[model samples]
Target: MTKLYASLALGLLAAACGGGGGSAPIATENASAPAPVAAAPAAAPPADSTIDCPMFPASAIFNTRIDDTARFPVHADNAAWQELVGRATPFTANWGTSSNPSDLQDYWGMPFNVVDAAATQWPLVSFDYAASGLVFEASYPAQSDCASSADGSGVVRGCTQVPASQRRFPFPSGTTLAEGGDCGGPSGCGDRHVLVVDKAACRLWEAFYAHRIAGQWYAVATASWDLRSNAMRPDGWGAADAAGLPITPLLAKANEAASGEIRHALRVTFRDAALSLQHVWPARFAAGSDNPGAIPFGSLLRLRADFAIPDAWSPQAKAVARAAQRYGLYVADNGADLHVQGAPDSAWDPAVWQQLRSITMADMEFVDTGAITRDARFAKDSLQAGW
Candidate 1:
């Protein structure tokens, strides 16, 4: 008979306290009763960087370990078990009355225990968020006590027996699997086993404790849950998890920000590296603009300078200008083209200039040649304030 594990029965719990506070109202004195009183303006919403979003406590982050020895039964009618079977089956195949034996054997090897079993109901066991690193302990009670038998009509039958053991397999370690690899590969294999319980021809199970690492809300560390017994096989598991996996909004936002920052940093670093190499060649400067293969360091420098200037041009402009002067060579043309001396046009071209414009405009209101030549101190402060 097919079985489901208790670990699959646990529900994902994501709780945060306190609704957003409303803006305070402005206060004014009564005209006739008292002296005039100035009203204070409402505070602006906090910047995305400064906002203190609630985070799951470290304790809650690693919950679900308690069910280490817990046992659970499986029944045909269990919702979780049914979900498991549905996921296990290939859409192209006709999943008839009997399940594949290899699949069943794989399920039995999972790291969970079977607690109880009956025809009408199945109670799966699992840990809370605090005990496990979001891994569920599952078991099938019917299979624990059932003995296989054959009926006279060429059909198979089984009688349920009581379970002798209620021990749980060890939890899988995160390091066991490297990112982007099969579970059976050198990096993906883990010492932990998973248990499943099936009853009423359905899989009833729960998963407990899922965690979001600090500074990485979207990047979650979850226990592996595979309906297919041979989840390590390339054919058993897909390239990525299905749509059912839960995702939090905070995680999504953080990921978006991180991606942007990475792209920005990469562009900046590439430009810096190219400039360092070009500064050593003096002959390349005299053979400017006409030579397509020649470097255009001056134009490149000017473009970077333009990108550093701020739209508001406050006291910060002087510092930004200094940074630009240090790294960039200016052509003095009406800010048209940038030409790095030693590096060929292929290294820094119009496309590069466009990219600089886009990144600077999006991140900062304005950028001038002076600002780009200045030291990094002014640029750092401007960026921190969201420019």
Candidate 2:
């Protein structure tokens, strides 16, 4: 983690200092200067818009954990990427040992490996946008009843028809449990799933750990509800439906049935362009604080090639060069003095340059200029083809 942070800080510093090994900043024309690159086409709008509402419904459920043999492929549309980037808002919590009971500490205090471990799991869960659904695969130790069913033949079968008496308690003999919940229940789960609408926060909260028993999946835990404003009702507007019952009774039953110690990985889909913009742009703007207003319109530009430093440079020099490559430098004039942004930091880690590179100039805007000199002596002797 420290090494990663150091590497990132170097990139940031290089970007701030400008000019080492990274791609040169896009040359902007002075008022009299001619334009270089043509304006890029606008990005297409997202496919859905309703998913952007803050109060939109969400759910968390457990699923049957599969062995390493069960493969979970990446979503064809890269919805996982969108969800992660959208939800990358700063979160603070205590860090703790993987299994040790009393090792809790602040969230960011945890090692990067721990954070990465959890993040990598995002794509492991399955998602369906048309149905607004999510499913997790979990595993529990093998049990006698599970073996009796069909010698593991029926384990992967779709949702079972649990009787009313059997539904009230945990599944009889599976070692693992997997859960799923969606806006529409008939397609996601029959009697086992609960539905919730307009309660986005609660759904997000519960989904974090609705699956996993002793580090495995044992059974599916599901919920569904409707979010509505009711002046006549307490708590104002809140969730209403879950697997068919009102929210209150469902929650009480959930608490009594399980310890509520569940971990979940959420995969959100952008229904339309509006939601994508709302979720992605602000984060980029905030991250560019080091460069201040230098990043154009908060757009990230892809690099033509991966920048690398040759072995000829000393380690320290190589570090500087690497930073320069990862974070392109900008030479801007502030009104009072020349200042540099994106300097490497000792505290912060460098994010993937590739991701940053994917942004374009149109996505960013030049909010301010630092300083410029009009004196002939300060001007270049001859016009340089590229800056």
Candidate 3:
């Protein structure tokens, strides 16, 4: 059975209070309105520079610490997911140097690009499998035009939003896609995700199954978000990841881990068979099997608070363990079970990564995100009003 949360009571009080009391009025109609706002799209939190790029507002769910049990609600399906996902499965760190430890460049994890200044421009070709109805901004000085046509899958796609970004990302010719290597996949072999953090614009752009062909780029789906805003994809829309979540923020970066603390949740993946076809708040698209009580996309899996981080472990490993206990992990994509995603760096000590492998699903539990999502006004949104 699902657990009840105080957040629902707070929602009632917030509604009964006409929400007139709080200053964070995302939107308001008549104060005496008979019912709370329908599941209408809520206004995004105003964007600003106080927080770094790729990190949403401090109040956002992704950045908030779930260790504060009072402020956030536990999801109803927590136990069900754990029973299905199992507690003894060991977690894997998906970043580090493999076979050729002598070769610094030989490592795993997706390649992420940071854009702080000028770069060569490449045309943003139409998508082959974008989530229908989502709007994307177009390039300012229009990109080189190409005939919109069928992709390798023979599915036709084109730009929908006329004045938005993302359809035109900031990759120079020959830029590598996610998972590395030359990105000239004319027919698409892998996910080939491309992630960019545009600090100047305080925006994040991500594309899935991206292909760089003949100096132009095309993708199956794309998502662009204002780092400062609480904007969320409409329910059931897919992005670079299946959970409709951003990829960069969830990664456990080497620099951040070496600093001794990672403040946000990390991303994890599971086999398709362990995933439920249904999704939870903030997760727009649902894929995988429809097994009853199976884990859903966007489920929060936290390291049990009692699980001690061995004192002898490297600071990097200890830091990740702490975050798993605090902010937790979000089921983001379909892949190996309990695979924890991280940023690959030369600075990473493979020994430290090896220590992290000791962590298993048995040391974790699911968090009910119901209360954190109470304020969200749309099925697709995960925005939460600031406390």
Candidate 4:
């Protein structure tokens, strides 16, 4: 097995950094400004209450309500997407019921403690956020020439406008960017990653298996998303994540915690539990084993909608609970069973946060995903003209 820290670096980094990998200081200096791109209209919420399982009133990332009213061929109003709702399954240990002698570590096993959130220490992946540079660096991609050697070297080869089919926003020239993270090292620490944020344009770019050698960034895979749109990763493509999804939208940010409700689904991990390196729709990884019962990467596990929340629970705990019941949790990586993620915040009460452990697999059910992967690559015109 890979080092636990290494295995964790991917999911945690995405949560901490942009897309995936580890924490790092987002470049505060302006490298290149991007042209302003009008934000896409929110996907109109569906009038059919039956199809809208989790009522995400707005785009969790962009602060715009998705127009659930419009039909999203990808998921929102898709018949295949609706079919997965209420698909029930008891959460098994490691997503399987074998009950073998396992010795995996759960990152979320420890209760929240002040020491855990000490500023000097590297915040765990769950706690990393954009404000602190733990998550994203609001900058632009670099404008430089790429050598053939740079293609696979994990080095930043300068910023180029990504193809419309590949990117959701217009990438301006002269954006500064890099790859890789070092959770244990300086600003960008942990595993390899790539990050690009166009503040002026309100966009983000990221990649997995990112690298940096001699102050240059490189990556095996990269993706871009418009902050304003309720866009989703194409069904079968992995975006810096084995799950083929964006990590930022799924994180439990401090603001959300403070709001007394996490409006979106959160990310979770398991102990070396991936089905494979190549994934299914919503997942880009393959099956880890032949076990048909194993939970694949990107599988959505949701708390029963009918589950009741205790009034005694703290605001943070209740917020998390509400999200689980509403949006559910997405399996992002392999490590610790039933370990949900949370952003770092010194203000969080340790005792209150510990209550999150009270939540368990017993409270959730695996969402059935039947035709999740049916869609092909997203066409440039799939969204509105401005997006």
Question: Largest TM-score belongs to which candidate?
Answer: 3
Stretches of model 4 off by over 4 angstroms after superposition: 1-197, 209-213, 230-236, 274-280, 284-291, 369-387
Q: Put down candidate 3 lDDT per residue, 1-387, tens digits, no spaces.
A: 000111123322333455245444212111233322233233333221232464776656667788866655455666666667677778788886532323335556765766642453434555532322332321211111111212111111123423233345555344454554442243424556677666665666676656655544566555666566665644545567777678877888877888788888899998877887667766665554455667878888888777888999999889899998888898887888899997667777777767987887777788876564554553335454344
Deviation from native of the Cα of residue 179 in model 1, angstroms: 16
Model 4, 110-223: lDDT tens per residue?
A: 111111111121111111123343334222222111111211111222323322112221112232222111223234333244433333333445544443333333333455
Residue 28 CA displacement from its true place in model 1, Å: 53
Writing each residue's lDDT as its tens digit, candidate 1 over 1-387 gives: 001121112211100112245642211111123211222122222112322221111111111011111111111223332232232221110011111222322221112222222322222122222234433323322111111211111111111122222212122222211111133321233322222222222121212221222211111112222111111111111101111111121111222222222111100111221121121111011111122322222222212223444443322222222223322222211111221111011111222232223332112111122222243422211111111
Q: Rate the local accuracy (lDDT) of all candidates.
A: 0.20, 0.20, 0.60, 0.40
Candidate order by TM-score, decreasing, is 3, 4, 2, 1
Best by lDDT: 3
Name the 10 consecutive residues with the lowest summed lDDT in model 2: 229-238
What are the runs in model 3 whose C-alpha is more than 4 Å off? 1-54, 70-77, 98-105, 117-122, 128-158, 161-167, 183-189, 375-382
Model 1 scores a TM of 0.14
Give per-model TM-scores.
0.14, 0.18, 0.72, 0.50
